[model samples]
Target chain A: MDIDQILDSVSPIHKDPKAILKSYIKEVNFPKGHLLLHAQKCEKSIYFIKKGIVRAYSNTAENEVTFWFGKEGDAVISMKSYIANQPSYENIEVLEHSCFYEMNHTELQKLYNEHIEIANWGRKFAENELLKTEERLISRQFRTASERYNELLKNHPHLIKRVQLSHIASYLGITQVSLSRIRAAKN
Target chain B: MDIDQILDSVSPIHKDPKAILKSYIKEVNFPKGHLLLHAQKCEKSIYFIKKGIVRAYSNTAENEVTFWFGKEGDAVISMKSYIANQPSYENIEVLEHSCFYEMNHTELQKLYNEHIEIANWGRKFAENELLKTEERLISRQFRTASERYNELLKNHPHLIKRVQLSHIASYLGITQVSLSRIRAAKN
Candidate 1:
């Protein structure tokens, strides 16, 4: 989709406001496995995925734990790091050759200050993110590993096809072996 | 604390804007154990707790799972229900005799439309909530049950004293027996 369409999908805005927002967004591309943001790095850019997939994960002492994936039309940011202007606890890596519309934190803040509609859009976006996070937390707490896998498959079948099994396993907070077994059982 | 002070703590605003916001806020009280919101109910009021604690939980077939707690100076809302105007998946209950400044969803939307500062405040509030929910999700995925319990104790010692052990266990996604064992082990 074009920038205008993407912006409209996020929140409707008038032509002048859309033009102002468009000025701040710079399109960029990255190859697969490209690290967009690293843990312990302070970066202030939020990316709107025009195409491709990205995975956000945290590295523990023993292993890397996948948190979530962002596909096309999704906004990818280390929210805590971006909001607090602190080092990120999670690393975001592109899993496929990607195109994104990048918005610098300072420019976005300016837009929020200048436009009430943008501020409202930001509120709605954050609320949606919170809701998705809450759903993930609830599933993790209440659903079994197999149940989670089933739900993931049912909800994001495309994701399962595109992403590696190990990454998906980590996202589910289960071992790859367990995931394999679950997959086998399903088959 | 008064409504003005609470609003100030969230994000500072000019006197006139503050007065406009104050007009929409209604102070109300609920006794301990009062069910402020129920699962599958579509209500759209966000409460800013002036005094006392509230718990948000979801009821599964097997048991009720406590998701999180909100104390004095916290905003309590079943956000998904409020945002989508759909039945909530979680229930909110008063754990202590509570006083709150309640703002209806429609009034909040109107305030956002009329006041840029209020919209900015809402954006900031939502961003903070997203940060918190992300933190909770990360901990749940990465931390051990005992580690989670210990973290809960260290961060929210007051919660331990105020709330039931059962609810705390539910929040940790552990049985009461497991929580007891973990507590004993820590001691």
Candidate 2:
């Protein structure tokens, strides 16, 4: 996405492109398999993807669960740890060669302090993140593996293409074999 | 539980106390049993409690789960719906007589746009909420029912005394009798 698109995602109603683009938000490029963030490290920044894909996942004794993924025009971060300035439980990795604009925690705060419209934009975006997390929690509670798989596909079709079957299976709280069986049954 | 304390929570380093006090926020009172916010209503306000207890919960045909509880210094709202401007799945109710400073979603924006520090404060608080939800999700997936119950008791012991047993049961994903048995065993 272009700078305009990024700015729009930020504050559609209020626009001051020049002021929002300066300082902390600098663009960075990554290759596939790049680990943009590490698990258990304090989150220092949040990223906005200009192109390509990023995934948030973690390894367990058994498997990896894809908790979140972002493509173009999306924000990516270890948000929990980022906000707390504590160690993260999840990692952010590039699924494809990607370009992102990075905003350090402090710079973002300074920007918000400097510009009310920008701060409002940040607040709304955080709200969106909160809603997403809430929905994930409820879905995990109420939906079955197959149902979850379908919902995931419905909401994030791109994730199906970018994510591995094993990761997808864990996210659905099922085994890889069950996911395959469900796929077979569906077809 | 005072306004400044709540304001300080969001802005630790540089806070504009009076600016936060403005921004369409109004001080109000809620009696026990008051429904501060209802599901499916379009509300713009979130409450920063000065006194008393409030609950955030959702009812299923089968049960009700306590998603969150708020007391003095906590912000209370139908959070998911509040952000999305959609029908809420959860309800916010006063569990005890309470006092709060409230502002509509628009007022929240007004504060953020006019006061960057307040906006950052909002982001931090929202991030805290997201972290709580994420941890709860992970716990639901990984922790045993007994473990979760222990956590609730440890973190919010007052909830055990204040909330209904059935709601607690639902939150723990167990039956009322089971909760009763557990409580009896513990006592």
Candidate 3:
């Protein structure tokens, strides 16, 4: 879907708000395995996924920890760097060849200032992102690995097929072997 | 600070925006140990702390997990419940006698629709909350207890004095004994 259609899907914005968004947002594409952002680099833009999947992760000395995955209709941004205006410790990498409507952070802020609907959109977008992060944090604190795996199966079964088991395990804060065991038990 | 001064501190909004916000927001006080919001209930309002501290936590069969703390100038809300419009699984409790500017979620939404600056403020507020949640998630995923403790000391040392050590330990995802050891070693 184009920007107008996507905006309509959420809430119908008038021509002025749509025009402001379209002016600042540009369509972009990336190949599979592309790093949209790298650790220690600042993220200057937000991407609204039109197609494919992207993963956000950080690394330790031993391995990388996958924390977030964005798919079609979702907006992806480095919350720390985007809000705090600092270098990100996480890398945002494409899991599949992806298409996105990309908006520079500065331009988006300008749009927010220029239009009320756009600002409301920005607020809703941030709230949605916050809700996702809070859910993940709560799951990590309270749920076991198997329970988390079950939640993934129940809520986002497509992720199991699209993402690698290793990445899924990392996202669940469990080892690949443990994830395998969970899968085996479920099957 | 009153609503006007608080709004001025962020960015000088005109009287229209300030009046709109003030109309929706009401000052309220809670005695120490009050549950501003209890588990399994919907959070109808967001609180901006004028004074004192608040703790947000969830409980398992075994124990309560303290996840967040809000102090002066902070806005506290249950992101998942507030954004998703569902009953909260966590509890928001007053840690001390507190004063806050509280705004009903529905009224705040109305204000966002009626005013551009208010929408901008809401957007910024959500972004700030998302940043904090992301930081905590990253810290939990990547940092050790001792490292997290050091970060807390460096960033929010006053919390150590104001909050109970047990709650602080829970926030760090460590046991009270481990926190005592860390403190003893530091001393």
Candidate 4:
């Protein structure tokens, strides 16, 4: 999808403002398994995925727990780290060979500083993300493991084929064995 | 707490911009048990509480599930409903007699449209909300029930004194019996 289209989808921006935002966005690539961000390191950039998948996870005492998946056309950032300007508690890794448009902190600051429309877009985008995160929180708090699995399937069926089952199990906060049982029962 | 101080803490704006924002805000009062928002009803306003508490929850087939508590200095909105311009899935109610500075949706849009600094502050505010929601999502996904209870105690010890045990149990995603057990174990 076109970058302008992605920006528009995020929040409509006029042609002139979109052009300015486009100027700051730099295209980059990553191989599968590459760690785009590491726990304890500060996040420096926000990425908009042009293609492929990335997983955000945190290393707990026992294991790595998957938090979310960002796929084609999704914007990915270690939001906590970026907003706080502190070291990240989570790591982000490419799950597939990925193409992205990255805008570093400085560029993002500049965009907000220079363009009111862009700033408005940023607010709307963050509001959208907040809503999504709240929904996921609600699901985790209120839904059964099977229900969460079904939700994932209903919302992002493409993720099932694209990422490993282990990652999905982690995201669902269920043991791999339990996930397998759920899948078996469903079938 | 002073409304100006709360606004400053959220994101600072200069005198002129602050005046513009202040003009759009209107102080309102709600008695305890008043429903600020209801499920299936579109949210019309965002509120900055100057005093007292509000609870956000959703009614499921079996029961009402508490999602969050917004206290003095906190901003409360049916964010999903406001962002999507649809009926809310959650309800917000005054848990205590409350005073708030309310800004309706159209007024918010006008502020964003006419004031660059206000739009920038809105972006910063949304980003903060996103980070907070992400933290809650992570906690729900990874923490043990007891751990979650401890987290709430650690972060907002005052809430225990303000709200009922049943509400806390709902927020923790545990049954009242389980919560009682957890509290007993902790004691």
Candidate that scores best on TM-score: 4
Could you estimate the TM-score for every candidate? Answer: 0.96, 0.84, 0.88, 0.97
On residues B101-186, what C-alpha lDDT tens digit does candidate 3 reach at each position? 88898888888898899888878878877887877888877777899889988988887788899998988887999999999998
Clashing pairs in 1: none
Docking class of 2: medium
Best by lDDT: 4
The number of the candidate with the highest DockQ is 4
Task: Report chain B TM per candidate.
Answer: 0.94, 0.87, 0.91, 0.96
The regions of model 1 sitting more than 4 angstroms off are none
lDDT by residue (tens digit), candidate 1, B28-103? 9999989888888887788889999899998888888998888888888877776677788878899989999898
For B1-187, candidate 4 gives per-residue lDDT tens digits of 7878988887888999998888888999999999998889988998888999999998889998998988889988887666888888778899888999898987878888888999988888888888888888888878998999998898888878899999999998889999999999976
- Lowest lDDT sum, 10 consecutive residues, model 3 chain A, at A3-12
- Give model 3 RMSD, 1 decimal: 2.8
Q: Can you write out model 1's per-residue Cα lDDT over A6-122, one digit (the tens) per residue? A: 788776778887888889899999999899988999888988899888999999999999988888888888787667788888889998899999989888888898898888777
Task: Report the C-alpha lDDT of model 2 over A78-100, residue by residue, as the tens digit.
Answer: 77656777888888889989999
Which runs in model 4 stand beyond 4 Å of their true positions? none
For candidate 1, give fnat to 2 decimals. 0.81
Give the per-residue lDDT digits (tens) of candidate 2, residues B121-143.
Answer: 77777777787778888877656
Greater-TM-score candidate between 2 and 3: 3
lDDT of 3 at A130: 84
Rank ordering of all candidates by TM-score, starting from the highest: 4, 1, 3, 2
Predicted model 4 interface RMSD:
1.0
